[model samples]
Target chain A: MAKTKARVKVPKSIKKGEVFQVKTLISHKMETGQRKNKKTGKKISRMIINKLVCQYNGKEVFASDWHPAISANPYMAFYVKADASGSLDFTWTDDEGKSVKKSAKITVAG
Target chain B: MIHKTLETRQVGRRELMAMFGAGVVAAMGVGMTPRDAMADAKSVTDAMMKVVGDNKPATGKIKLDLPQIAENGNTVPIAVEVDSPMSDADHVKALHLWADKNPRPEVASFRFSPASGKAKVSTRVRLSKTQNIVAVAEMSDGKFYMAKSEIKVTIGGCGG
Candidate 1:
C-alpha cells in the first residue's frame, strides 16, 4: 500500500462571519493508467486522488472532484467564512476507496 | 529534478504511443477522426449541463489562467478565478473545469460557501493535446458563468 499524508493551513482565529483562505496539499503519485513497469512490462493500474471535501463547523465549505489529469501531490486553495469556532475537516478519497483525513481548528473572535 | 523526470517520462509516453500506432493521433492534423472529436465535445456538453441545468453560462466574471503553450502534456498548470464579493448574499457555490480533448471531459470541480472569502483555485492538469480548457462557476443565485483558454500540448496528457 502506498503511504499518504494530508496537510492543511488555516487561521488560528478569525472575526465572526469573516471569509478566510484555506489551503490543502496531499502527497500522492497520481499514477495514470497509462504507464508500464519497466521490469514486469505490465500496465500500472491508475490510482489517483479523486475527490476532496472540506467542512467547517460541520457544514460543507468546500469540495472538489479530481481526475487523473490532476498532477501528483495535489494542491488546492479556497476561501471560507468563519461562522463559529469549530474544526475544519479535510478528507481526500482515492480511486481505491482509500481516504486520508486531516482537520484544523478555527476560532471565531467576537 | 522534477523537470528532468517529467521530460524522461514524457519521452517514454510518446515512444509508447508510437509503438502502439498512435503516432497518427500525435499528428492530429487531417488524420484525426471526427467521431473522436465529437465524443469529446459531447462529454464536455454533458458536464456543463450537469452543473447549470439548461441555463447558458454567460461569459465574463470567471477567468481561466493557463499556459498558451505547454511543452509537457502531463502537467499543465491552471487557475480559475471568479469576480465576486463572496458574501453570504452573493457568492460562488461551485466551480467546474473541463478539457475539450481529453478522454474524460471533466477535469476538476470546486464547491464553496460564503465563508470562503473568494472564488479562486489553482491546480495542474493533464491535456491530451492542443485544446481549450473550459471553466464554469455556479453562483449563489443559481446562475452560471464560464471562461476558457486554449493551450497547446506537445505530448498527450492522458494515456494515448
Candidate 2:
C-alpha cells in the first residue's frame, strides 16, 4: 500500500454568488472483502473510504456516504455557491475511523 | 474398431447443453455466492422501498446520465442532477445512487445544502454487469424524486 493522497481542484475564477465546481480525487485500493487471498486462501477483508464531507467556511455544504461500489481511486465532482470569501475543507473517512483531511481557500469578494 | 467405439462414447450436444443449462441455473440459485449474487427487479424495488418508504418517489426532477454502453465496467462515469432552486427555503436534501445488479443495492448517497448552489454531482462507480442505475433525490420538504437508466457493460467489473 502506498501513501494515500487526496487532491482537490477549484476553479481559478470564482466570483461571488457564482456556482462553481469542486473536483476531488483520492487514492485507495477499495478492497470489497469478496476476493480470497490466492496463497493463504483467506478472504481479504474489505477496506474502503466510507464517507466524504465538504465544509465551506464553518458550515457543511456537501457530504457523501460511500459504499464498496465506489471504484478504486475515487473521484467526485460537485457544485458550490460561494457567497463570501472562505475556506473549503474536505475529509474522507474509512470504516475503521481513519480519515484524511484537505483544505483549500477561495476568495469571493462582495 | 476402437475409433468407432470412441465416437459412440463421446457426449452428444443435447447432453452438453443440458449440463451447461443446469450450471447456469445453479449459479442463479440463491445462496450460491452471497457476495456476488445477481440482483433482480423485485429485489431492487424492495431495497429502494426501504429508503423512500411510503413517499413513492415521482420520476420527473432527476436527470441520470450514463453511457448507453460501457466498454469498461471498472470505472463507468455517471452524473446526476435534480431540478431544484437550491434556495434555503427549498433545496435538495440528498441524492442516492444504486446499481441494481451489484451484489449490494446501495452505491452511495450525497447530502446537499443550499451552499451547494446546484443539485448536481458526478462520480465513478463499479458495475457488476449490465443493469439499471437508479437515482433518487430527496427534497428539503421530504418529497422524493426518482430516475432510472440502464448501462450495458461489455465486461463485468467484478472478477471471480
Candidate 3:
C-alpha cells in the first residue's frame, strides 16, 4: 500500500492583510504506470497525488490536482494573505485512496 | 544402413509446417521491439491536448522561470509568475504547467483565489529530457494567457 505525507511551513505570526509565504511538500512515488517492474517484468500501475486542498479557518483557500508527471516529493510554495488568526489545514489524496493532513496555526498581530 | 534408416524416419510435411509456424511466431514476438515507443507517446499527447483546449492565447505576461541547463532531470526547480494583481476583480484563476517531452504533459495545475494574494508559485518537477516547459494562466474574466521556455537537460532524468 502507498502512503502520502505532507510538510507545511509558514510563519508563526503575520500582519493582517499582508501576504505571507506558505510552503508545502508531499511525498509520493507518482508512478505513471508506463514503466515495467525489473523483477516481475510487468507494467507498474499508475499512482499519483490526485487532489490537494488547503483551508484557512475552515474556509477553502487553495486547491490543486496533480498528475503522474508531477515529480516525486512534490513541493509547492505560494502566497496567502493573512486575514485572521486561525489554523490552516492542508490535505492531499493519492490514487490509492490514501490521504494525509497537516495543520499550522497562523497568528496575526497588529 | 543407419543413414537410410534415419532418412526413413525424417519429419513429414505436417510436422515441417508446424515447426515453421512455431518459428514464425517466435520471430514475430521478438521482432515487436520497444523501438516504437514514440507512437504510444503521441497518443498520450493527443489526449492531453484535448483536455487542454486551445481557448488560451500565449501571452508574454506569464513568465516561466527555469534554469537554462539542468544538471538533474529528476528534480528541476520551476517557478511560474504572472503579471497580475491578485485582487477580487482581476485575479488569476489558475496556472497550469506542462512538460512537452515528459511522459505526461500535464505536469501540475494550481488553482488560486483572490485570497491567495499572488499569482506566483514555485516548485520542483521531473523532466525526462531537454524539452519545452509551458505555463498557462487563466484569469477571472475568462481570459487565458501562457508562456513557455526550453530547458536543456544534461542527463536523462525521470528514470526513463
- Candidate 3: stretches off by over 4 Å: A1-4, B1-56
Find the candidate with the highest TM-score and give its number: 2
Say which candidate scores most in DockQ.
1
Candidate 2, residues B73-160, lDDT tens digits: the string is 8889999999999999999988888888896666888989999999999999989899999888878887889999999999888655
Report the C-alpha displacement of residue B117, candidate 2, in angstroms: 0.5
TM-score winner between candidates 1 and 3: 3
- TM-score ranking, high to low: 2, 3, 1
lDDT of 3 by residue, A1-110 (tens): 23556789999889999999999998777787767888876678888776778999998778877776667888888888999998999988878777888999999988
Query: Candidate 1 has which clashing residue pairs, if any?
Result: A79-B116, A80-B115, A80-B116, A81-B115, A81-B116
TM-score of chain A of each: 0.91, 0.93, 0.91
- Candidate 2 regions exceeding 4 Å error are B1-42
lDDT of 1 by residue, A35-66 (tens): 77878767798889888889877888778878
Q: Count the backbone clashes (under 3 Å) in each candidate.
A: 5, 0, 0
What is the C-alpha lDDT profile of model 1 across B1-160, one tens digit per residue?
A: 6897799779876764553344234324332222222222235765565455556899999988888899888888888889999888999877878898886676887777776778888888888899989888878887889888899998876654
Candidate 1 ranges with C-alpha deviation above 4 Å:
A36-42, B1-42, B154-156
TM-score of chain B as predicted in candidate 3: 0.68
